[model samples]
Target: MATDKHCKNELAAPSADQCMDHYGCIYENNHLITLMVDPADGSIVDANRAACSFYGYRLREFRKLLITDLNGGQEDDTGSFLDRALPGGKYRGNQVFHEHHRLASGQHIDVEIHTGAMRILGRDCVYTVIHDISERMRSEKRLRESEERYRDLVELCPEAILVYSGGTILFANQRTEKLFGIVKEELLGRSIDDFFIEKPLSSSEYNKLKAMSGIKDSFRIEQRFIRRHDRRVFDLDISGVPITYNETATLQLVCRDITQKKKETERAVRLQEQRHAVGFPLEDKAVLDKLYIPANTLSGDFFIFHRISDYEVLGIIGDVAGKGISAALSISALRVMFMDSLHSGLAPVEILQDLNRRAIEHMGEDYIAGCCFHFDFNRGMMKAAAAGINEFMYKPGGGEGMRITVKGTPLGMFAGSTFEQTAIPFQAGDRFCFYSDGMELLFSSDELCREYEYLQGKIAGSVLQDDCTWLSLLIT
Candidate 1:
């Protein structure tokens, strides 16, 4: 027979009476609140020292209360717990549940109950070890809230961001669904390469040693992708950022769509090549060496020299108001109109008026700054006029250069616009030049003086210089 004295030596086939000494030792010394309750009525039969103190009750007082009473009228929940915990009054299994327990002082505390079936005096009893888990539960809830906030922030990001390790995707933001056309669940755990039409780095180019040294630059590639839902092809500019996520080294891929922009860039290059073919090549005259370096694909400035009679040549220089395709197209239309007027041998003033009217008719409302000069070699006379362009410089053989005035309102503003011509008697060595207003902006003060000196040298013999210094908003 088992005795309390024998328990001090060794636990016999355990029963409440015989194992009381061993059980009492554990009950007295254990940190957890413990109790023995009759499985039949959920009533407490025994209370450990910790349980008595934890509930603000003495041992005898704690024993009279039902376990369900401590759990705040949770008889049904307690019954369900017992069904799983003891299971037929014969099981030695344990079960755990979170429940609120009331203390003798009327304070409520959340506890984690770990219960097991025990035989005490040949009857079924429930042995429970309860841990106060209030703080731990609160901490877990806070962690969940923090993670939810982070997810909300990332979901609103415009760029598709993804984290992957070992070639498999671990996380993706909300934009991944729109950008890649795959739901977040479907994207997760899939091979990272599955979405991209373009593969990642070449095997030889991937250097583990450099990556470990933190010297690895993030790799970027413009690649095509197959959208998962629509299966449509799209372009993406992807950057592979090496990072540590969740304490593990991984690659975060950030992608942007550039399919439309990519095609526009390609088309612009082709148009730029064709744009260079517009201007004419002059027969090399000792006085002029021409070079046009456009700031972009097209130039807003253009010039032409057309021979009218054996001894007369019409020199034209013009600038459209702005640059690019719109300005280039306007210049083209104006060029055709001006040439026709010049061929008809219209006076410089009449040529300006005719071209202005034709330009407004064909090109709609537009701004043009232009100068046309008719130089007669045999007659030794020159006639020049402009619309928007006001004056130009002239120098004669053995004479100082000075500005010659010929003014008109810019074309296309109104039908009543008028033009005036400036005529001069020419000598064999008299010269003039026509240029765009942007010419001055391209040069600094010292550069301008230096370039003017160079131009003076080129025109020393039969000189003609155009001093068109119409500075507006003054290029500083």
Candidate 2:
């Protein structure tokens, strides 16, 4: 019944003749926020009911406020807009302005204002319509910030990153410039295929890149690239992932320089082969047992034994400075020199002096830590000399084990560096052990064979930080 009554009232709406009487009533009751301002003094002349509600101001209060008060000083002088509203001016027609407006609650908001010059009752005025655009402005600001963060991440990445389409380069990060030895300006808009020496993208690789699958869907291959300036070819490990760049389906590539790693790997293989070829010579000697374990693919440690006579064996165990290829090379050269001195019939002390002189002349900054010894089974005597390697275990049969220490500087430090030699009588059933500093020996046990076995097992299971080599002899 109530709905019917309201419909009947709407159908009996005012006639055109009576609508003229509601001329001011329409403007006052309109839902759009509207205002009439005194153009001469920038004062508010009138405000509609919508303006009052939107600004949280009473009609009487709005009439006393200036347009600048609501505009937050955006227009310091109202003439700025009036000057543009004149004929031949930029905003001669209905003018538009984007501004920040201050609300009655002291909050600021973005707004779009549409304004027009008007005359009412023989007085000039400016009619304005305001639209709140605060939400739109906030959304645009967030989008700009997100784009800035993405650009920063790409530029600061350590590995070379690039985006390409159809073998053409679209984007390359800062690291890419350094990797290719080309400036950023030169890298852009270039063909990505030109940089690689390998064949261009394959059909399967392109298909995988276009799939736009998850991260796990990417593929990696080892490729070769030549520097733009030097033209030096180097190895690269590249991973390609399907990505959408600039709203287009494209590929993102991450490249890492693996040239040095490949060289080191090959060098290590060669060093291991050398060690295998130079196997322990005295391993067949019945009274001698030796163990050697390297810390890395290449070792700085080495041991050499030569049978000088039927009852006399000359040997040296040493460690060179540094590791990897350089140290391994040094050990290899040292072994040849040791065999020469052993065949010359030089004593342990004389051999150390000769080796020191050679090391100073040839090794340069490199140094050697070594201990040389001569074992005479028939005479029951042990003669040892020290250079950096100071102490070794010596135990007589049925006697307490003790360390024999002879002080000397490591070889190659000073020219003519003297070494100390110690002669200890070792009879049948006595045991002598020569080892590098890498091994820690207590010499608390008289049973040298058992201790040597235990040390070997322990060293085998442990992770060594340095090369460890030891030789044990049981005089029998």
Candidate 3:
């Protein structure tokens, strides 16, 4: 057995003779990739079994090559690494060098080498322990790319976003600067109390905010924000959501300016209330009951009834295909067209054709789903024509109720599209229900009161996703 001083330091045996045999056994059978190189000439002095398996080189072949041969001849070769690893021939604790090494197959891998100065049989040498770090490097690269993409999205967002902790602003997006009328450098480190008129957040309130995990769990409120430069107060809808920023729990505030929206909403409410106050033209004839629920302040669904004669009435119900103020304006135009058609004494089919033409010319790209019907009390007949508003529930006097569906293209869809008309006979005590597409009903009962209660319960239990309107008529 060969005597090596490195073993005496590592095994801590009582004497050099006792550690000689154990050192050789441990070095030859160790799992870690190990190598011993002559520091003076950079020649490979010895290699363990693990190093031979990792580099695909026999011990004899490893001994013939220099350390730089396996290191791909990088500038930080054996001599420079040894200088950094063991300055002044003394081993610096935990000195590591990150480098690339080439295998026997010419493949290269990222590695971190732990090097130390050692003496084997009175000769100076450098012992290196190598570890593969390719996977960790790839993971770090992916994390960097993901963070860059997230930063881009936050900068380009339209709404103002700010990250804060304990009422102190930590981060703010570009929109935040524009909304607050302050530069980003000035906005950061400012207190939330400076901008908002709301009460300062208590310690408990902040803890509650930090406990939130998702958008649904967040807190939202409408408040007033004062601009830092002009001190002008504006309405804002804000949401506070919990997030992790730089390994710290923080609250992110998303603020939306709603000053203009509030003004528009007030005007729309006044108009809708005035429209509702107007009397229905066919009120004296047979408007038994009605319901109108708009999803927004302005409604897209509308109904109008005009009595043509003492024994006859004309009624039309429709839904516009858009939302907001634009859809409300379309309903206004449609109401005027319906009144004009009825005054001219046009039939149901002719009235629909005329409305379709007017919709294409005046409504631009907006379309409408409408149904018009004529009731003749003396003739005991009802005639209905539809475009897009196709299905209706009809219950004859002393008969079961059935759905009446007519096939027709929506108004303003095409210039030459045709419509179909349906006619059914009815005596006294017959019931009719006309509705827009937003109303979803099972029609389980023929009575109008039961159906209306079902609809009311449905609306009460769930959030409204669209506008709904229904009209019930009874023959007397």
Number of the top lDDT candidate: 3
Q: What's the lDDT for all of these models?
A: 0.66, 0.75, 0.77
**Model 1 lDDT per residue over 1-476, tens place:** 45878777674455667577786777789878888878887778888788887889898887778777887776554565466557676566788877877888998888899998787556777888889988988877787787678578778889888886776788899888877666888988886457644433443333321233543468776666565445677777877777766657777778788878667655654554454343322222214433344555456666656666666667667777666667666766776787788755557888888877776787666677888777666666778888876766665666665667687877776677888898887665555645566554443332322334563443343222232221110000
Per-candidate TM equals 0.46, 0.50, 0.68
Top of the candidates by TM-score: 3
For candidate 3, give the lDDT.
Answer: 0.77
Model 1, TM vs. native:
0.46
Off by over 4 Å in 1: 1-19, 75-81, 105-107, 120-124, 163-165, 170-174, 182-188, 199-253, 260-476
Clashing residue pairs, candidate 1?
A: 393-467, 431-463, 431-464, 432-464, 432-465, 433-465, 433-466
Model 3 has a clash total of 0
Order of models, best TM-score first: 3, 2, 1
Clashes of each: 7, 0, 0
- Measured with C-alpha atoms, the lDDT of residue 210 in candidate 1 is 23
What tens digits encode model 2's per-residue C-alpha lDDT throughout 356-472?
888888899899999999877677778999999998888778877787889888888899688999999877778788888777542233333356578777776777867777777
lDDT of 1 at 463: 22
